[model samples]
Target: MSKAKKKKKVTPNQQTSSSKWIFWVIGIIAVCILGLIVLSNMSKGGGDERAALTYDNQPYLGKESAPVEVVEFGDYKCPACKNFTESFFPLIQKDYVDTGKVKFYFMNYAFINNDSSRAAEFAETVYKELGNDTFWKFHELLYKKQNAADEKKDVLTESYLEDTLKEVSSDADAKKVASAFKDGKGKDAFDQDMKTANDLGITGTPTIYVGGKKFEGKTIDDFDQMVKDAAKENK
Candidate 1:
């Protein structure tokens, strides 16, 4: 072939190669953009807004940034209510809550009136001082000392609940916090908590929910399975 003809042919081949390179670059950029969007959504915790509310407004104890929130409504005088707190709470804390899988909010039902509030106050006082970890310690103690609070009449009264708290916690604040009952400060908080429970129509104690569905069971172990079930539902 002549030298001019060969040069023209070479120019056309170079143009085709350049076009192929441009298409490959565009495909690579598109894949990178899609991957980034997926990663951004995952990092935002799947878009659940519950993360906005912290251990504020209520006696909450756990990771504020957890993906799931387990809200419990309970009265201290009820045995089944005790059962859930005693058995399930620790498990959830260890298996899920402590690991940032779930957050916890204890919505005080005060079903037994001021006495129940007194018990709850003990937990709150601990949270104020030692934060969430200490509150968990006191909670386990309350259920362990269940016999003292088992009786309906005594456990439902102001003075008796304070005495119950005194036995479990040696913290100086225990006495101060318990004294809220005698001064009527405890009664006010208790009333407000009970009103919340009534508004929710929670006539029973130890009412638990995972993603807003109540856990139904006669014992704590029974609901352990339910916790697993609800967690799956959320996914």
Candidate 2:
């Protein structure tokens, strides 16, 4: 055999070129991986955004098959929330809710005070123990009382809530309602509502969402038009 050709040793420049090529390949792969990871996180974030607005399993009004969905985040002791119930809500109820164009839901954002939380828990108890119809009835009664008040008062004692429940429905066992409130039967639901409100960045009561977007309108007419627009879009 011819004397073995002296092995062609890699020169430094050639070795450096080879190393540069390998580094480039690794850099490209790393960039692709990072892009995939970023895309995955974006997808998950989008899912969470949608889930935040679903308002699933919460108390609702109108037909279950209603095309558009509306949600209200409210506090029992919030004057603005009471104003919504007294004024804006009835108009919506008469138009969209009663007409079966929208399904409306309510969640407690009881951030006012201890009484606010207590009222939320009491309402939850009414929903759980009494039923949906009675819950709505109780809800209206609570707001009505809030409206009738001369000024804001922390009157939501256990006894007061028990009395109010009895007043809302003669069929209600005041003692049982009181017992349920005391036993923390409604605390879990109230807490869940609180967590959802927190996640949604709700800092005030009477925040309304229509068709998975926050309502920014300042007038009832705007809200009405929004509902109409949302209904049309859903169809």
Candidate 3:
């Protein structure tokens, strides 16, 4: 073989070697990235599947297709839920939810161990009767007045519930909106919520699951690190 023939053989071999190394490096990096993400999500609940609630036509605040889920099964009459909503939700909504770092859901159940279930059911019914925004306002107001106590929680009575609906309404006859809360209109929704809660194994107010792991707390601060840790995985 002459000089050009020798060069051609060597050049082809060098190119082939370089291509093989490139593919190997790329594959390794891709796997590392994928493993990191999987590990991150699995940090919570060891990757167990959990229930997602869909009632009252509520609008979700975070990314619909998030890799992590944070579901809350709470009672409108639960004091812990009230405290979390009043104090912790602001931080959570500001941080994880508003930033689209996590997918969030709310499951309303009446478990103050009292007639509060009636209030919860009525709230759900009114949300359907009213609109999304009005329902949200009504829900918040109910929690604000609610104090889930040990002896007996003070669930806002029918009149107060009606006042809340009216206060949040836009002169649209909130009384008609409040009417949905009466009789058994809300009972069906209340039952469905309870069934879902039972299925999810929820045992308390402010029961939260991040990636299927229970977040034990009466406030949002308890799950801060978990959220950060989960985000680091996705990023």
Best-fitting candidate, scored by TM-score: 2
Worst 10 residues of 2 by lDDT: 46-55
Point out the higher-scoring one by lDDT: 2 or 3: 2
Predict model 1's lDDT versus the native.
Answer: 0.63
The models' CA-based lDDT, in order, is 0.63, 0.83, 0.69
> Rank by lDDT, descending?
2, 3, 1
Best candidate (score: lDDT):
2
Native-to-model Cα distance after best TM-score fit, residue 14 in candidate 3, in Å: 74
Candidate 1 residue-wise lDDT, 65-162, digit = tens: 65566778876656776777776677777877768767677766765655566676555555554455555666666666666445465553445545
| Candidates sorted by TM-score, best first | 2, 3, 1
179-227, model 2: which lDDT tens digit per residue?
8989999999999999988987779989888887678889888887877
- The runs of at least 3 residues in candidate 2 whose Cα sits more than 4 Å from the true structure, single-residue gaps closed, are 1-51, 147-153
Clashing pairs in 1: none
For model 3, residues 1-235, the per-residue Cα lDDT tens digits are: 6666553455888899999999999999999999999888876545434435453344345766565667778887677788888988778878888777777767666666555666677677776676556667777887776644532745466776777777777545577755666556667666777888897767778877776566754445568767766566666
